[model samples]
Target: MRKFQNRSKLSQYLSEQRTKVSSIGFVPTMGALHIGHLSLVSKALSENDFVVVSVFVNPTQFDNKDDLVKYPRTLEKDIRLLKTLSENRIAVYAPTVEDIYENKVVSKSFSFNGLEHQMEGAFRDGHFDGVGTIVKRLFEIVKPDTAYFGEKDFQQLQIIKKLVELYHLPVKVIGCPIHRAEDGLALSSRNTRLTEAHREVAPFIYKTLNTAKVMFGTKSAQKVTAWVEKQFKKQPLLKVEYFIIADIETLKPVKRKSTKKSYRAFIAVYAGDIRLIDNIALN
Candidate 1:
């Protein structure tokens, strides 16, 4: 697999490829390549002539310095996995912090007034802005015909959609389904940090959402949230950060209404010091 660090070299490589009219699919990641990330890479490989995966652990996305410090970095293992997945056809671009953002000058900030400030955004200030800036930068660097993002980070996906619309970018943004474990826990790099007991109990978040969806069919929104909160609260290993039955688009807590619409059951939990998020949709 070919690798390029600086933009000039990447641009030069892409320019040569463009002459041949090759369609590129991009998967941008904060390199701790879990199955969730590889799922996107797999999708890209299936649909495009060429695939480029950028592995840069973006510092701006983390609100907590300690979290950033402790964030997993498995570059050698990640590269080995990617090589095996690609079967020698994938190109990897693992850039240094200096190479990606030398001066730290953010081009423009994306502001989704209501959507950015709720749930995950409420807890981590400027988290989506960090997400937006880094993603936008990657879009500029990769300049792929299509970009893939996993739906595990639902809010981040929404924000990226908005960013593309607002900026009138040429690339297509696609959201892939969340990959999960056999037991239903959402696949995440953070999952590696969970203790055995917490890992055993973590699937309850999905179970709670499943129950909430069934209850929402006949019950009020308040009842659903209450029940979900109660179930999560019962888990000694899981501490619920925020639990809400929200409108899927707005991410705002929903109230009972006569006409049915879409809803999302979302949760962020702190199992010891590691934070994990998962959600399910109810229609």
Candidate 2:
């Protein structure tokens, strides 16, 4: 696989590829590559003639300075994993923070129709703005025909789709299904930070979401939310930050399920200092 750290060189390479290929796919990541990230890249390779996987850990997205400092960085190991996918078709752009932001590393303001003010937004202030900033910058840099994102970041995925619409960008943003472990915990880069005991109990997060999905059939959204909170309260190790069943589109917490609208259960749990988030669809 071709590797690039300089934005200019990567741009030149992509420009050349554009002439030879009909379509280009892009997958933006923060390094520390895992099977979940590879799943997105694998899908990108299947649909496009060429794929570009960026391995830059964006700084503006972190609301907490300590979290940013603690975030994993494994560029060497990440490239090795990507190599196993495809050598000729994949290009890894592992740029430095300076390469992405030039001088000032700051986030730009974006109106996601209040989508940003719920759930994660409620807790991590300006988190989505940073997400918007880095993603927008990368989109401008890569300029791919299509971009792939995992549904694991369901809210971010929606915001990115909105961003493309607001800017009238030609790129297609596709949200792939959430990749999970054998135990049902949604795969996340932060999973590596989980302590051995916490990791064993981590699967409970998904187990509760699955139970909430089944509960939706007979219970109100508010009741289900209460039940989820209660379930977490019983577990001392895992702290529930926020759990809500909201409309799949607006992301506003819903009181009851409707036949015309779809809903999803989103949860954020703290296993010690490591925070993990997961969501499940409820029909």
Candidate 3:
């Protein structure tokens, strides 16, 4: 696997590669590698002639400076993990912040339309703007035929779909399934920060979502939401940030039960100091 820190060199090399290869698959991520990341890489390796995985910890995405500062940086370990996957050569673009955001440090306003008004977009102000900027930038640089993203960030996935549509980018945005631990906790880079006991309790987020899923079959949306909040409160260590039952297409909260439309349950929680989020289908 060849590693490139410079975006220019990587882009130039890929430009030449475009002539030789039929298609290129891209998996863009923040540095701390996990099973979830590898799953995306696995799909990319299977589908395309060449694959490029980027591990740049984007500062613009985080609203809080401390969160960005404290975010995991396991570059050597991340590379070691990625090496286990690709049988053929894979390009690992671990670019510096300057390489990605030379003049543009802050995100310019992006219209994800009203999709940006709720969920993680609502809670984390300018979060999706940072997401849009970085992703659009990477898409331009990599110039891949297809890009892979995990559905753990469901809202972000939807927004990127919008980003491609708005700009008329040729890249295909393939939403891969959210990978989970054997116990059902969604695999995350942030899982590294959890203390031993908290790690054990983390799967409760998924457990709660699954429970809500079954409850939604008989109960009203409001009732299921209240039940979710009450259930989380029972665990002293876990605190519910927001438990939303919404339409999958529009992402607007759906209060009434309807047979015609598909629904989903999304949750964000604070497990001690670390915040975790998970979602499940209500159908």
Best by lDDT: 2
Q: For residues 1-283, could you state the per-residue lDDT of candidate 2 as single tens digits?
A: 8999999999999999999999999999998889999999999999999999999888899988999899999988998999899989999999999999999988889998899999999999999999999998899999999999999999999999999999888899999999999999999999999999999999999999999999999999989999999999999999998998999899999975789999999999999999999999998
Q: What are the Cα lDDT values of the candidates? A: 0.84, 0.94, 0.89
List all candidate RMSDs to the true structure. 1.6, 0.7, 1.1
Write one digit per residue (lDDT tens) for candidate 1, span 143-248: 9999999888888888888889888889899999999999899999888878898899888888788888888889988888778778877788899998887887
Q: Which predicted model would earn the best TM-score?
A: 2
lDDT (0-100) at residue 167 of candidate 2? 88
Query: How many clashes would you count in candidate 2?
Result: 0
The residue ranges of model 3 lying beyond 4 angstroms of the native Cα positions read none
Ranking by lDDT: 2, 3, 1
Q: Model 2: which ten-residue window has the lowest total lDDT?
A: 255-264
TM-score for candidate 3: 0.97
Model 2's lDDT to the true fold? Answer: 0.94
- TM-scores, all models, native as reference: 0.95, 0.99, 0.97
